[model samples]
Target: MDLGPGRRAVPPRFVLPDVSEKNREGKRTARERLVVEREKQKAAERRRRALIVGASVVCVLALAAVVGVLAANSGKDKKSASDGPAVAPSGATGKDGLAIPVGKDTAKSSLTVWEDFRCPACKIFETTYRPTLHELVGAGKLKIDYHLVTIIDDGRGGSGSRQAANAAACAQDAGKFTAYHDVLYDNQPDETVDSFADDSKLIELAGKVDGLDTPAFRKCVKDGTHNSWVVKSNAAFDSGGFKGTPTVLFGGKNLAADPTMTPAKLKQMVEAANKG
Candidate 1:
């Protein structure tokens, strides 16, 4: 049998290629590739965000550590009143946290001390000579009161004055004003970034002194209830012509803001009051 030159016998049941199906497969593949790319992009974004957050946390922690170290190292060595007597807290709480002994309101030679908690000099005064003053107060010869101030060096986050005052207030409510007062001075922080505004430090400090309930102290600090007292004290300080801390007023007479106001000077002043 003759056949066309280009014709050949075709086999039965041969597989036919489906163009539309191939196109569908190609489209599916493209869709799957697009989905994978989107997933990769999302994962990359998440990783970037995590990295940024981690870096920020590291930086904050590093800064805080440095500040704490500097503060720890900057404090001047304090000399205690070795020859003077020790005093006890009267355990009195006034309208604010101002604690005064309850008795006949006799006019003793009083000293109104102006202090800023962030003031290093104030720390020295509080640490070195406060015990002597305490002795005098307990002995009914002298009365010492605090005038709080919060003047920041550059308006950075300086919570030294406020924290100290508020903690004192909390301690006052807990009947531990003097003890808490000493602790603040003892744990003075240096002038650095992340200074004294740290809530953790305040909490740690509160835990150290007895009679101050931690939860109550934290709430008081967060609410800033004692800020008004600090404000009033600052106003009083301004009225008294004070520019810095440790400005003592002996019998209402202004004393210098010297860091070197020794125990001898304090005793001499008290004795002079006794003579008069």
Candidate 2:
């Protein structure tokens, strides 16, 4: 050390430790790696969210499709039901399976009727003479046979006559033949509207009859179980050498031969036939 009176003492130089380039580069690389990892994680999170959204959309569409299919099937079932016929009354018997017999089979005098359900004239005849026939039959004077014909169907554009006859046969099976027969006349649709072709309407009419409309009855009607029988009956009617409907026969004699025959005259004819 030198004396310090006229000269400043020399100070020692202090040096800091130098950082290595490789170490700095390594720190920078580490920070960059962290940033890149964060970006990759963000990208992965976005992709995951998108996939979740897509899957949810697919599920919703699938649910909608299922609902649509169910609705379509339901509508188809109803439409199917609306496109058929009525059931025949149970245990209804006839000659050659053509005519459904009414009243006492053992009665002395017999009356046979050939009719079409959709015939307006037939409807009038039914409305007028049904009660009278019932009265005679109740008195053990006559038995009746009903032959269902479909001439009206052949002429009319729809299956009204056939369907109505078929349904009447079904009612015959259900023991409500008379009731349904009257109902058909009462609800006849202007002879031009073939509403009876709609089996749903026929079933609705069956509901009006007591102990007539039932599940089995509906099934029978819808299935057209007696359609073939009705066909056979109509064929028989044709083979019987008859052209028009509402053909009335008493003891194999044509009673409706007179075009202007009144209901009272009709009763009188039956009474005369019974006495003979």
Candidate 3:
């Protein structure tokens, strides 16, 4: 239909949306978000790994510091061990300075027992033969001379063996050497760990013995007043031509090398020696 020029029909322009362009823009946005999230995760992992590494380094440093401190203390103890003056317990002591008598000097038979406080075999022998020794000594049939050695300390480095021997000497001064000595064997620490290196443990053992927990005993042990005596005792042990500890001698004859020397056999030996 024809219309006048002013009333002519106009054609409308339809603008279709660009769907592919919109899809491309959405994909680009998604890819950018994924990249940002991935970067965040990587940063978090880096921080976690850094923290773990830092903690490990700190632990290693602490362990090294502890080891260093322990080494320094061990050296200090060794150096101070021989620095001070030593005291001896009063008794009919030995000329070699190692023998501590447990029975009368005028007894009919003499039995000498050599022991290292750290020696496991010595502990067994002491435990097995204690009853026999007590009976013989009490009956005036035999006397005992205890020689303490520090072979364990010399062969394997630790203050425990020497410290224990020194404490035994202190106990001797308090007249409770035998009691303290037995207790020490009864509660002997493992051979590797240096539990006896602490003087407090010796004082604790002294407390087990009657009248041995006195201030004098404590001071003697803490000051290592018998350390030099322990040194001399070790020298005597070297001079005795003994190969190992638990050396038992009856009437100046060694009984340890005899396979037949049981506790019962030891008692018989003491009786026979007394008769002789």
Scored by CA lDDT, what does every candidate get? Answer: 0.54, 0.67, 0.70
Task: Rank all candidate structures by their TM-score, best first, as comma-separated numbers.
Answer: 3, 2, 1
lDDT of 1 by residue, 1-276 (tens): 011121111111111123366576764553464355345435644565666777788878799888987678663311111122211123533344443332224535677666666665466456546667777777777766655566532223345666566557666666776677777778877634335565567667877787575677777666555655655555555575654455766755555533234566677777787778
For every model shown, the clashing-pair count is 0, 12, 0
Q: Which stretches of candidate 2 lie over 4 Å from their true place?
A: 1-94
Tens digits of per-residue lDDT, candidate 3, 1-276, equal 011111111111111122476576764554464355345435644565666777788878799888988777874764245645445666737785568998877788888877888766566567657887889899988888888877666544577888898889888887888899999999997655678888888888887888999999888888788888787777777786775676777766677666446567777877887788
lDDT of 2: 0.67
Residue lDDT tens for model 2, 1-276: 111111111111111112466576654553464355345435644565666777788878799888988777874543233224423345555666567888887677887888888765566467656777788888887888888877666654567777777788778877788888888889988655779989999999998899989887788778667776677777788788874567887767665555445456666766786677
Number of the top-ranking candidate, with TM-score as the measure: 3
Instruction: State every prediction's TM-score relative to the real structure.
Output: 0.57, 0.65, 0.69
Error of 3 at 108 (Å): 1.0
